[model samples]
Target: MAEKDQVAARARAVTERFQFGPWSMMTVKSHILKSEGPTRERFESQLELPQVPEMIFADNVLRVIHDDGYGIEFNALDALKCVDAHHDPLKVAVSQAWREARSSCEHINDVVKPFDWTFTTDYKGTLLEKEDKKITVSETTERIDIEKLKVREKILFYEDMLLFEDELADNGTSLLNVRMRVMPSGFFILLRFFMRVDNVMIRVNDTRLHYQAGKNYMLREFSTKDDQVKEIKASQHLFTDPNEIANHLTLRKEVFEKLQFPETPPEEGS
Candidate 1:
């Protein structure tokens, strides 16, 4: 119990929280990186990857809680879980190269499992369960009003946090991060995972959430875009920036959902 308390205390030191309408949003940023610790061990075991990313902020998380007890969160562990554990045909070339280079290494007996080395994940977010207040989700025809978000409004709060990142064995880079902004009208969040494999391909997975103030539900969208490296006609410098890389890739898939909050209040002391 003492050790657990200490760990929670440490996490609290780097976490920040704010309230917007009926929702409470929190962001955590930690400095701990790749190290031999319980956090790293748990990440490896759960992810079941040959190796974890170069930089995994296991303690970092972005969470939103509703006053009625419903909650949703984005974290490194859950995001990584969405990564493809089996060999992906799109990344076979890089995987083969990696294996060939390591074949002559000292750890010849160590088996290297074939998996997506880029660590691309399509995770939108994880939902939190509250005693009896259920949050139901379904496919929605309604989409987030991007034009409304463009309108000028008083910014109440804002935060951007990195969940995890990797150098992709120096072949390129893989990263995931989330950013949220609160306005007088509502709140919007973007969780993005971007990857660049030199001379191979570029991929971007984006999850957008929009909650209008006083609304009964929240809107969520997930999108994926990718293209062969040779197809993109842009300055090499732009490829290095995740924010800019998405613009060059082609949209591959999209899914929109609505999370409906329970309308009725709980019974008293049932």
Candidate 2:
């Protein structure tokens, strides 16, 4: 038993030496850890493989919050080469946290779009006679005073769509989700038409990545609720699937008049 313990310790020492703490920190790291488990144990943070490419890591603080919620930080000095995670146990912890932060930001877009609408209707003054609908013509011949028209301002929003990529974690798939917040620049407008998204869409390299709307991911209330990623959708090639690719068949707007409002939008007119 003593010899065995010595061997193990020696091996660990060799491994640590292999990981060059003396070397320096790496510029950037990134990754996506998808999960399909329960909410409590969902997506395990993953170290961004060399691919995700986060330039910010080169000049930013890497922070990791364990399950306990205590934050652990990794400093990035000018010589960050000391960050070889191969043999360093702490390296994995620190790298995973930074990677998750960067990767998790991908869903900031679809999740933050419009939600509801409010505005004053163009109503003529109330009178004894029934209100007659005014037809909106191309151009009115008579000059109308702008002051006379009722100025009813309204805000509009819709249920947001939380967007994410398909990947696997030990617990479940991690679905990147975000809520729409007011644009700081347009504070006066509030949640009105002046809204601007602080975060943009994550560039999904391949739409061929197969993910079912309800199965792989679900969003009941994008702003206040969490989304569940049920499965890891297999990436499929749309070009090879003749039947699947036909949905994009373009049709003229005139042909779609029979379709309902939400079900189908009129194709753009020529």
Cα lDDT, all candidates: 0.80, 0.20
Q: Pick out the ten consecutive residues of candidate 1 with the lowest summed lDDT.
A: 100-109
lDDT of 1 by residue, 119-213 (tens): 88999999986898777788888899999999999889998989899876666788999999999999999999988877677889999999999
| Model 2 agreement with the true structure over 131-167: per-residue lDDT tens digits | 3311111211222222322244332211111222222
How many pairs of residues in model 1 come into backbone collision? 0
Worst 10 residues of 2 by lDDT: 187-196
Residue 13: error of model 2 in Å?
55
Residue clash pairs of candidate 1:
none
Each prediction's total of clashing residue pairs, residues at least 3 apart in sequence or on different chains, is 0, 30
Model 1 stretches with alpha carbons more than 4 Å out: 1-12, 92-111, 264-270
